[model samples]
Target chain A: MEERISLSHGSGGKQTNNLINDLFIKYFNNEIISEMNDSAQISLDGSKRIAVTTDSFVVNPIFFNGGDIGKLAVCGTVNDLAMSGAKPLYLTSAFIIEEGFEIEKLEMIVKSMADAAEEAKIQIVAGDTKVVEKGGVDGVFINTSGIGTIYENTNIKAYNAMAGDVVIVNGTLGDHGMTIMCQRSGIDIEGELKSDCAPLNSLVDSMLEVCSDIHVLRDATRGGVAAVLNEIAEMSKVSIELDESSIPISEEVKGSCELLGLDPLYIANEGKLCCFVSEAYANQVLEAMKKHSLGANAAIIGRVIEQVPQKVYLKTIIGGKRIVDMPSGQQLPRIC
Target chain B: MEERISLSHGSGGKQTNNLINDLFIKYFNNEIISEMNDSAQISLDGSKRIAVTTDSFVVNPIFFNGGDIGKLAVCGTVNDLAMSGAKPLYLTSAFIIEEGFEIEKLEMIVKSMADAAEEAKIQIVAGDTKVVEKGGVDGVFINTSGIGTIYENTNIKAYNAMAGDVVIVNGTLGDHGMTIMCQRSGIDIEGELKSDCAPLNSLVDSMLEVCSDIHVLRDATRGGVAAVLNEIAEMSKVSIELDESSIPISEEVKGSCELLGLDPLYIANEGKLCCFVSEAYANQVLEAMKKHSLGANAAIIGRVIEQVPQKVYLKTIIGGKRIVDMPSGQQLPRIC
Candidate 1:
């Protein structure tokens, strides 16, 4: 029953309340949010540790083929907190919306955000909205700040990637970036391939439950896998050897990357993660990941090692060795 | 000897360090920032209470008449924490710059940011940078998150505005917004009535040191006095009355308002504060403010009363009482 977004949508008026209650609250049905207060107040256990992370999304083409900016904003922040080995509990979303955008689209985006938050089990607590003239804004810009509770028993960081730790990926890389690219370019393939954009906390929870020794948990986003590996190497002061044959890539994704001159390693991914674990428990993490729909393509593609300090090397199918470097510049702009 | 901000400024390269060091660190001149890192770290006494506040500045034109976005970002966040009766300690600045911005301007902005932070006696701690395409971004946007250490006995909220509490203004309002407007409109004026964009932390600190009976503190921004008072009323669930003759308005500001057909009450102020204090200590706080250059015109303009719960009423110069209301729509777009 929502019409196109009028200026009142952000006016903190009837339209604002209606939009929040009818769509946002309806979809993101949760205890804390039901009150619709300025911020969500929840009790924090003194024994539980807390982690904070903030991320901004300037994704162009707010509404894309498979997903929209709202969904991306929620999933992106939630995933970041999850990768830090925290159970994301609260989020603050600040929106920079351009004037003259449609109301229906606003509702759709808000609904998507609510749905994503609901699925992720996080409360969209505090939010701020500022609008600029039509030309001054790029449709919508979102900054999501997440606060999560970290269990006292979990000690996770890039520095924990010890020698011989196995690198496990929850699913195929490039699915997210490629999907956005294809959709933006209006490419229609025989089989539909949308972005694998979902909350990865549950999948991450599974792995943590199975292997408490998970060393490094990283989401392959922005600079992607190569950048993540480089970060781990730099922090852990060790190298990683990735076997090209062991890495998993979908045929569609491989074809898309090959055609677009994109390296799958550098392409961003969502609803997927690159985790490191001790070789002894690598299989256990992989097994837990395979149990989740989002992690159906889980694989043990590499291992941390003592050779070549602070580097990542990949073996090629043709038996060639090449450095898998951290992405020097943005690979695909606005892919997330 | 700093070069301008170019694409290399955010390339995580040498240029970035030079800008941060030569301009930012130099102006900041803080021990913590002198040795540059991803974030500024500080060790605070565990016993001191802390106050946290975050704010984002997206002021347009990047450069305004008397200030820029960089300066505004730091002052705004620090002031928020200070208004909460805290002594600001550290700040985090995040920049979202558009590609192809001038490097020289970027350096100036960074220098301005550091200068403002230092002037406020707060250190720039953590930061982040993201770039959008030429079409996707404005010149730049800055977000500052600040944390302050609150003294054990300092606690002030709007709800504490008891009946007969005195309402005070740190200085004349409408200067900042008018300066921005004049510059944007290319209005030439003689004698240079500059924007009052100074940090109010020192004033707050001095007042808190002398007078611990302060009931409420607020920065009159966006909707200026109207917005801030309404916030206090709602939070305190109290009513307030303003004497028109007591409210300080600069002659130039009044002239500009008349010419522009704008209401001074609804204009924005970046450097001024609206405070409610117990009548006993109101004069003491006002005396402290008058010592600072920014608060030379500070005055006790109103008083709180237990009538018409949560409303602000103003007595016009013509001896008529009119209820003052917060502007439902934004009066100034992106005015920090």
Candidate 2:
């Protein structure tokens, strides 16, 4: 482990994994916490199951193309709960704002958060606000924690993926990462390149309505699709072979990533999700996902295979295959 | 409202109230959210009542004399839920670390958090870590959100206080604020002045066992006893008369406050709490509190008076009466 924390420690990549396992897990060792999943599943009175998740959004330029920090904070937490197949019920937001920030901007950000909450059918039940002196912090940081109720029959988890399952993503990738990068760098592309930041609870509900036998459901947030698939492969002890030609990528985001010499698979996507479902329900789930606006670009990208256990492979359009390794270092910091 | 946010906006005083009311409440106006109390009261399945709370700890110098930021974070959120008469069940922690912070220090902090959770009989179920660039933030800031189950037949809220209720505070006041101030300012006193940051759930449970009719329970944290009493007075539409000589204050804290020309009432505390109960149950609750180690100095400092509505009065030792107003501006920032 590094002696001092670096930007990579928060990258949701290999270094972040090391920090969690080497330090966080070492000290916070417990049954539920050690699962190391996106959310913690807890049972109430040995009858009801609930999922809880937390995330802190320190995205630079609090305001971005699709949404602001507040909107991103709510969606991030809600999506985490949805990934666990829980219906997000309540959210708590804690904001740490630097002194001298514009009150109008704060109001706008909060309004955006309220709007997002309404769309997701979740309530911002509790909140705390702290203001620090100028230069003590950046513009603002929002931490949101959500609670959701998981139904009785849903058996969704990262470790639940099986060898014969099919993989599907709800929408396009790299839109959020590239948009934030473009906004921060003050660069403009020929067409509008907005973030794909949205809540996925509705889409998850639509899919579960058609088929609740999904093995794995994960939102490709910090590390994009590659990271999520790689983690699923490792956790479920299965191999994933992705068809590159079937992966959905917007033209604007693709052009932005190509111009910057970045791989779209490694970029972040806020309002997207990838699911592993039984082969019998893959087409039905994909069709259901495509019915929703947020999942209009739904596509089947890959399938779980038994050849390379605990690994992910990308079968390129050029008839070549390469390992889709977990992201290594900080590709882009503060890209919530 | 001011054009830009100032340090006073987060002071947990009058300015903080203004910011919350004029902005946060204006847009997030809802029945439950408009209450604007420490924690929000929420119901699940229309049968089970729960309390959810969130707090962000930006206490400077992350390490302090009695407790570090990690301990403060857990105790802060736990106390919030305890104030709502809830048995805290789970907590989620999100840490935002500066780029160059030492890994050893973070480990120590996480260890502190775990120890505090164990003591409070809660689990640190889920967590998120985000590392910002160097100079982007102070050493570390932790945001903890807690979920607690509110037992039946316990009606406790800020507005539940009545005119004839008695006010009781467990332990001494202002220890946390003074200790942090002394540590940050490099001033050492002759005797020890440690922070009173502690979990008050056990004490609360003891009191509840003795008397479930406790009207209001609140921890005197940021703006201390004065801020809490004033808010209760306004919320319940009642007046309070406090005997200055009856309030508990340690000798060292009194001396420090005298030397610094600061009112002990306006200072912060972590382990202390104040409750409002009918005069009938005050003695029983006080006896129960005194039985616990955390409430050895529990005392009846005041009672709800009918002289003035929506006001608070302090009767001095010299037999003079004066108004105890809400704190106006930021006396101490980042004191947890």
Candidate 3:
């Protein structure tokens, strides 16, 4: 059995090939990868078009409750392209591995990335590997670049959220961040806390089928809902008013946040998306999102309006109005 | 002065903006990067182009010539695309920094990446950072991913080498490897050998103007000349014969190799290239190479053939044919 990765694994020889086949290919079996060429050649149908997006995942621990860094890396990039109303296609992965990291762990991460790609209906077309001396590198940092086919002439961007567009979320917030924090800090919650890492491209596809004119689609990560709102408001040059009662939040995540002195809105989410759609099409998008396992807790939480401030404001249940600012610092560093 | 990177540098807040503006923007000061946008959108002209070839640099100590990680990362990827005859456009960098490393050292590395991007006329469009706990990581490791635009009509691949093709190296070999080895092993071979890390896209532009039909361009990197020859023979299914006497080697590198029990051929090069061209235009290509500063020692070392064995054979000074094979395993790790 392979105990760990020796320096020879990155030497571009038989060891590299063997490792890729035994671990990576076994889990990430796909048509493009089967060739094992330098770079995967993706044949695109001109009529269909293409979209490209790249994202890097440096989540703290390689493995966590519901997923691992590999799964998060694949899902993250796929979702970025999917948000542009694109049908995800090919993906390229780059890995920075610290010396002395267990080869088994890397294999696990690779497997997870492959599995995520399969679930998202995308191919891991190309990849690169770099090894850093021990102490100079982190365990593993992953970057993924994806190219996808856009479905027709769909136009979706951060600035697409118009005045009167309704804001909707696919699921509860803070589950991914809280799960990791609890695990890393040895904090026990009243209930089991699991990260929500998952691929949301299919759910995006489904929603786009119904609400083809959806104003915006964004994954709630890093700075979470608050940051997403800030970006959208700035891009659209419009203000957004959010209803605290309408935003979905599970009691478990809320409790965990309170215990840790963290704001759920500022925390990260892996399996969720925050979408803004025209009021007329909001219900259809919500229904489509609800059909997917990733977006079952979907809810409409806010509306956009023409305003000079182009800011986001939250309306508490007690009739208090306050600005919802983007998180000042990373709420969860190393979050995918 | 702050000696190390604090949490502020990555906070995406004031410090992050400052770092971008002060150091990165100052050196890398390009219009695209200056905008500080998430991605760069570039306009390209339609032309017949295939990314074309080489790089060879010696990292001293066999590493640490200048950039143990960051600059090396940038030059490595940029040079690869240059070898492919592609116009490099975007890059992704990954870092492995050892724990307890002076924050200043890490910042310097990052700055080196920024500077290399500027000099190579590429963009640091994407990046990743990871920190391995002390002893778990090394001083630093960098992996760079570069994307270049391929000119639509230029078709170039290793398998395209023809039997009547003439081979030429951009410059002399073993200088980079020898320089690094001498420095690392405490050999004072005419002062610590300085690496030849450099970008070759400019040199390629000059050569392509004259000989765009050059069959194959390969960078002589790890495993050096022997490895590249093996690849060409297998890819084109053609026999290759090299005259040992025609190949160029520096006296310093030869001396260092002899003293250290190493083969100059097996050592890594960071800033040189190997080119295969049609014999009819070989002399023209040689003249073009001679005009460039980096190709002072350019030499026609070998040629392709239709021999049945389809192997790379080197004719020794005594007229004996010996086999040249790919490296069996890691000759030197972390050379990048």
Candidate 4:
């Protein structure tokens, strides 16, 4: 590890994993965190199970094309719990605001959080506010911690991927990362490019109705689909093969990535998730997902394989095979 | 409200209350948050109740006299949960680090956090880390959210104070605020002065054993005992009378405050808590508190009165009385 913290340490890629494992886990070692799931599953009174997750949103632009920091804060944590097959019930929000920030803007962000919590059917029950002197922080940063109840007979985990499982993505990728990148760099695109930052608990509930035993469920946010796929592959010790033609990508995001010399596979998405389930239940889960408004573009883009264990391979439309490696450093900082 | 947020908005005094009520509670309006206890008490499965709380630490000079930001972050949230008469079970930590911050320093912070969590007997089950560009933030900030199971048959709240109840403080006051203020201003006090930052869950447990129905248990942080007493007075619709001579203030803290022309009442103490209990159990509670190391200097400082409802009065050593009004603005910022 480097002597000084770098932007890549928070990239949600290889460096982020190194920091979390080498520093955080080394000291705060415990069985629950050792599992390395999106949320930590704990049993209360040794019977009732609950999922807990926390995230701090430092998106550079407090407000963006489609959503603000507040909405992203709630949805990010809510989605983490949902990925663990939990029904998010309560959320606690804490804000660290820079001095001289506009009060009205703060109100707007709080209102957005309230509205997002309403959409997710969770309540923001406890909160704290801290104000620092000018320049102590960026405009403002919000941290949200969510509590959720795990569903019965449901065990969704990253290491649950099996050899005969199929990989499904709910929507197109790179919309969120590309939109923020363009907005920050003053890039004016001709097509629609807005963030896909919405709570996915309802969509997750719909898919679980079809099959409660989904093998792996993960949201591709900071490091994109490629990162999540590589993680699942390593954790489950199973190789994965992706079909490039089947992977969903929006036209605007594709154009933006091409123009900016970036890969859609490495770009971030907020309202997207990758699901792995047995091949027998793949179509049923996809059909259930497509019926929801947020999952209209759901597609089965990959499948688990036994060859070359713990690796992800991309099958190109040109009939070529390439390795999809975990990102080494950050491409976009504070994208989510 | 001011057009822009001032340091006072986070002072945990009058302005902080206004910001919370006018903005946060107005938008994030719910029955749980409206209770406005240190931690929100909610029932899980409509039977087993739990307490949840969140706090962000932005104290200047991360390393202070007796504790660092890491220890402060854990103790702050743990104390909040304990104040609600709950057994803290888990905590989630989120860090927002600035680019180029020292990794070694971060490790020390993490180690301190681990030690504090171990002392509180709580597991840090989930965490998130985010890094921003250099100058985007001061070195780093931490937000900790705690979850604790509410003890059965216990209902501690701010509005539970009765007219005959007595106010007791666990230990000396203003050590935390004065320590930070002196360190920032380069003041050298002759006597010992350091933050009393420690997890009080065990101490609270001891008191609960003596009387489960203890009323208005609160840690005197940010705005100190004066602010907390005023809040309880307003909430319970009763007057509180404090004997100036009985209030315990360390010799160092008293000298520092006098030298700096600051009032000890408005200063913060991280490890101190104010307890309100009926006169019947006050002696028993005090005896139990004194048995604990953290409460060796415990003293009964005041009592609730029907006169001057919704106010706090201080009785001087010379038999004079004065109003301990809720501070309007911040005397010290980022003292937590």
Candidate 5:
């Protein structure tokens, strides 16, 4: 391991996983936490189960095209819990503000957070605010932790994917990562290149309403769909075969990624989700997802296959197959 | 509100309250959250209540005499939940680490957190890590959100203080704040000047075992004992009369504060907690607290008085009386 932390350690990629497994998991070893699930499920009163997840938003330029850091913070954590088949009910936000920040800007960011919470139908129940000296931090960073109730029939896990399951995605990939990249690098795009940072709790709820037996429901965030697919393959000990043509990729995002020589598969998406559902329920879930505003681009782009266990294979446009490994290095720092 | 946030806005004093009430409470207004208690109590499953709290630690130097940011983050959130008469069960930690930080230091900090959580009998169930570019942040900042089950027999609130209630502190004040101040300023002190940052759950549990009717419990962290008293007074609509002579202040902290022209009353103590109990159960609770290692310096410092509403008065050592208002204008920034 590197003696000093590098950008990749926070990239939500292979390096990040190694760091978490070697340090955090090794130190804070416990049954519930050690599982390393999207959210930890805890049983209360001997019966009811709740999901809890946390994420910190350090996106550069706090305010962006479609959503700001505040909205991203709320959506990120809420989506994590929702992906775990839980109905996000409460969220707690902690803000670390750099001293001398504009109070008006702070108010705007908070108002954005409130609006996001309202959209998700979740309450911001508790909060903490800390201000650091000038130059101590780059503007403000927000950390949100969410709590959601797990329904009775819901049993979603990364390892729940089966060989007969179908892989589905809720929307186009890489809009968030490309938008942040363009904003940071001062790239001028002809079209409207904005982030896809929307709350996906409603989308997930709608999908689950159609089929409760969804094997694996995971959000494609930090490391993007490639990383999520690799993780699901490894966790379920099944191979994932993705059809390149079937995957949804917005033209603007694809053009930007091509210009930047970046792979859209490994680029982060905020509002998108990757679902591994039973073959019988995949069409129904996709239909339900397409009915939602955020999931209009829903597509069943892949399927679980047992050809090679613990690997993701991308079927190319040229009819060749290649392994899709987890993202290794930091492609975009402070993107989320 | 000021145009730009000054250090005082995060001082956990009058200014901080105004920011929360005017911005956060105004935007994210909901009944439970709008109350702005230390922890928000949410009823789940129709009858079971759970307390949730979030706190972000931005203490300078990352590592201090008695504890580091990791330990402080865990202890702070756990203490908040405990103060709400809840048995803290789960916690989520989110780290915003500056890129190029030493991995060894990160490990040590995480180990410290694990130790603190173990001592408090709480599990850190989920976590998120984000790395910002160097100079984007000052080392590392931690935000912890805690979930605790409210005990059935307990009902503690800041506004629950009765006119005849007695206020008690678990130990001496100002050590944590003074220690950080000295460490940051490189002050050479004679005696050991370390933070009193420790888990107070066992101490609170002990006190509750003896008297479950404890009216209020709160940890004196950011703006210290005076700030806690002022909030309690305002919330409970009662005046508190403090016997200055009975308040415990360590000799080293006292000397340092005197040299710096600082007030011990306004200095934070991480491990120490202030409790308001029914007059009849004050002695029992104090005795129970005294038996605990963290509360060895337990003392009854003040009592609720009906003379003046929403105010705190101190009976000085020289037989003079003075108003102890909330410490304002950032007496100590990043002292948490």
Candidate 6:
């Protein structure tokens, strides 16, 4: 491990994993956390199960095109619970605001958080606010923790991916990451460039109704689809192959990524998820997902394979294959 | 409300309450949160109940005398759950770390957090880490959200205090606030003045075992015992009378507060808690509390009265009575 922490440590990629494995997992070692699905599953009353997850949003600009920090904070935790195949029930939000921040902006953020919670169909049942001296913190940071009830007979897990499962993504990738990047860089892009940030619990519920035997459900957030696939492959001890042409990408995001020399596959998306289901239920799940507004562009992007265990391969448009390695360092800091 | 958020808004005093009532409560209002209890109690599977609480620690100088940010984070959430008459089960920690922080320091903090969780008999099941630019955050700020199972027949709450209920405190006051204040001011006090930071779940369990009908249980933290009593009085719509001579205080802390011109009633404490119980079970509860190491200095300080609703009075040593008003503003910022 490095002697001092770096921006890469929070990039939600290789360095972040190293920090978790070396420090967090080493000390906070427990059966639940060791599994490290999107959320920790806990059994209550012998049979009932619940999912819990936490995330701290430090997005720069605080306000983006489509969503602000408050909305992102709510959607982030809600999506994590949804990724665990759970119906998000309640959320707790804690804010650390820098002293002298505008009360109007704070109210706006809080209002958006309430709005987002209502949209997610979850209640913000507990919250705390702390104000730090100016220069002690930048703007405001929100940490949200969510609780959800797991559906019976639903066994969604990263390690549950099988060799013959089909991989699907709800919508376009990298819109969120690129939107933040472009906004930060002051890059004037043609057409609309907005964050794909929204609550996925409802969309997840729709898909679960179609197929309760889904293998794995993961929201591709910080480290994006690439990181999620890598983790799933390693956890399930299977290989994943993605069809580059089949992955959904908005024209504006694709253009932005190309101009900025970034990979859409590894850029963050708040509303998008990578779903793994058996081939028999793949079409049915895709149809159900596409029915939701958040998943209108749902597509079959990849599949799990028996060959090359724990590896991820992408078949390019020209039919050449390339490895999609886990991101090593920070590409953009504070991009949520 | 102020145009800008001041340090007073997070001081856990009047300003803090104004901010909460005007903003957070106004927007995030719900049945559980509207109660304004230390933790929100949620029912699961009809009969079973659980408590949830969230707190963010931004103590300056990360490392304090008796505890650091990590231990405080864990204890803060665990104590909240305990205050709700629940057995803390799981905690989700989210860390916002500044760039270029020492990895060794983070490891030490994480280790202490793990140790605290083990001592509290709770598991740190899920966690998230986010890194901000060096100036974006001060050293490290930790937010911990906890879940606990409510004890059977437990009806503890802030508003449960009745007219004849007796009030008791577990230990000395202002140790934590004074420790941090002196540390920041570079005061070299003679005797030991460490923070009274410890997990009180075990102590609470013992007390609950002794008397299950405990009324109000609250940890005197950020705003100290005075703030807690004031809130309780208002929540329960009853008056409280504190016998000045009966309150427990360490000689060293008393001397330091005298030298600093700080009131022990308004100073923060990390481990101490205020208990309100019926007079019939007060002695048994005190005895149970005294049996625990953290509650060795337990004392019956006051009793609830119907003379004046929503008021708290302190009887002086010289036979004079004075109202202990809610603190108007910040006394010691970042004291925990």
Instruction: Give the top-scoring candidate (DockQ).
Output: 4
TM-score of each: 0.80, 0.99, 0.76, 0.99, 0.99, 0.99
Give the per-residue Cα lDDT of candidate 4 at B143: 95
Q: Estimate, for each residue in B21-115, the C-alpha lDDT of model 1 and write its tens digit.
A: 44334433444334231122232233434454555567776888778998888888778777777777655555566666664576667778777
Q: Which runs in model 3 stand beyond 4 Å of their true positions?
A: A1-51, A134-138, A149-154, A188-191, A235-237, A305-311, B1-70, B92-143, B182-187, B305-311, B317-321
Docking class of 5: high
- The alpha-carbon lDDT assigned to residue A70 of candidate 3 equals 90
| Tens-place lDDT digits, model 6, residues A196-246 | 999999999899888899999999988889988999888898999999999
How is the predicted docking of candidate 4 categorized under the CAPRI scheme? high
> Candidate 6, TM-score vs. the true structure?
0.99
In order of DockQ, best first, we have 4, 6, 5, 2, 3, 1
Q: Which model, 3 or 5, shows the larger DockQ?
A: 5
Per-residue lDDT for B208 in model 1?
A: 81
Lowest summed lDDT across 10 adjacent residues in model 6 chain B is found at B305-314
Q: How well is each residue in A1-336 modelled by candidate 2, as lDDT tens digits?
A: 789999999988899889998887887777888897889998655677889999999999799899999899999999999999999998988889999999999999999999999999998888888999999899999999999998658989999999779999988888999999999998898799999899999999999999988889998988888888888888888999999999999899888888899999999999999999999999999999999999899999999998844689999999999999999988789998
TM-score of chain B of each: 0.84, 0.99, 0.78, 0.99, 0.99, 0.98
Q: After superposing the true interface residues, what Cα RMSD does each candidate give? A: 17.4, 0.8, 16.5, 0.6, 0.7, 0.7
lDDT of the structure predicted as candidate 6: 0.93
DockQ of 3: 0.07
Which run of 10 residues does model 1 chain A get worst, by summed lDDT?
A36-45
Candidate 5 per-residue C-alpha lDDT over B75-191 given as tens digits, one digit per residue, 9 for 90 to 100: 999999999999999999999999999999999999999999999999999999999999999999999999999988888998898888999999899999999999999988889
Per-prediction count of colliding residue pairs?
7, 0, 37, 0, 0, 0
Q: What is the C-alpha lDDT of each candidate?
A: 0.70, 0.91, 0.66, 0.94, 0.91, 0.93
**Every candidate's CA RMSD:** 13.9, 1.1, 13.4, 0.8, 1.0, 1.0
Writing each residue's lDDT as its tens digit, candidate 6 over B1-336 gives: 789999999999999999889999999878878888899988757778989999999999799899999999999999999999999999999999999999999999999999999999999999999999889999999999999999999899898999779999998888999999988889989989899999999999999999999999999998899999999988888999999999998898899999988889999999999999999999999999898999999999999987854699999999999999988877678877
